[model samples]
Target: MMLDSETTKTYTRPISKAWWLRDRGHFNRRYFMFLLRELTSVFVALYVVLFIYEIFLLTKGPDAHTAFRESLSAGPWIAFHIIALLFALYHSYTWLGLTTKMQAAGRGLVKIGTKTLPPILIALGSYGAWIIATCIIAYLFLTL
Candidate 1:
């Protein structure tokens, strides 16, 4: 005996191309921040590409590398660097803060003995390490 079966079509709601840009016909602070964070990632990726390109330029000879560095000192390039730096800083802050957020949400807790660490301490420790590393790098670069 053959069994009879009915095939059902799955329904999918069509999404607009700009759905991420629009949230329920309006924009909110949380949505705006989400977009900003995503945009920062683009800036960060561009920064990484630019850094790699700079490294590649070094292989072309000092003149070529110096020219690239000089061009980057121009007003527009300076502004772009500043903007990218801001975005990168914001991105890093949010990325590192995720640990604290997770702790607060009771999702990814770090335990010491039988007690879980608080979010504020987690945030401070992460940011503190960042500051220390930044200072050390800056010191080495400035000395060099």
Candidate 2:
């Protein structure tokens, strides 16, 4: 059973049983930066909500603040931070990559801004952040 090329749909290639065997490296950007951006957005939203809830509890009374702070000492606390760390890293990478794209500028549309920062420099910053984050995570694993 195979998905007919005419009936199947993908930006670069049709869905098929042989999809896994297909050279996906050549696949288009349809499944792309938007996903990473959305994911990071979701994580940021969750963080805001969680912190807001904590603030609410703090305003309610001292016991609530104690419970909220105590929650951070447990396993779930570590998991939350780990997920946040991954989302944050992806967000940074995507932002830096997209930023380097040349943009047309000026009200007359006669000029172009060729990019203030070099792509390699932005890439280095992104990679540098990843290395620093990985080291921190490794340290946490060893000590915690």
Candidate 3:
């Protein structure tokens, strides 16, 4: 007797345990960059957790907080922060590029007066705002 198509079991190929690293040697620059971009989240999450822990230490008193800060000044932690900063900047740049692409793709949805705004202009505006905000925060942090 022939089984109906609906009753047939379909088999899927099993994925290799090391599938993600299978072609590490042959990946193009874009592929590597994409992987690095994803890796940035781990650093970002780590930094956030460290920041929260520092805040918690603050409640324990000045000595605890000072000790924590001193610990972070060690060589390994300094290197980690430097690496994390680089990755964070890379991630931010990629995100901004994506935002530009999305805005360009949707330009027709929002017209300004007689024309759509340029994508580069939008990107520059975003970068400009980021710079301004950073400067303001830095100034406040330094002065107050």
Q: Write the per-residue lDDT of candidate 1 for residues 1-144, one digit (tens) a residue.
A: 323335545554555566667756775678678889999989988989999999999999999999999999999999999999999898889998988999899545898888888889999999999999999999999998
Looking at model 1, report the run of 10 residues with the lowest lDDT sum.
1-10
Highest lDDT, which number? Answer: 1
Error of 3 at 52 (Å): 0.3
TM-score attained by model 3: 0.78
Off by over 4 Å in 3: 1-25, 106-110
The per-prediction CA RMSD against the true structure, in angstroms, equals 5.6, 9.6, 5.4
TM-score of every candidate = 0.82, 0.51, 0.78
Candidate 1, pairs of clashing residues: none
Order of the predicted models by TM-score, top scorer first: 1, 3, 2
- Say which candidate scores most in TM-score: 1
Q: Which of the two, 1 or 3, has more lDDT?
A: 1
**Model 2, runs deviating above 4 Å:** 1-34, 103-144
lDDT of each: 0.87, 0.68, 0.80
Local error of candidate 2 at 7, Å? Answer: 19
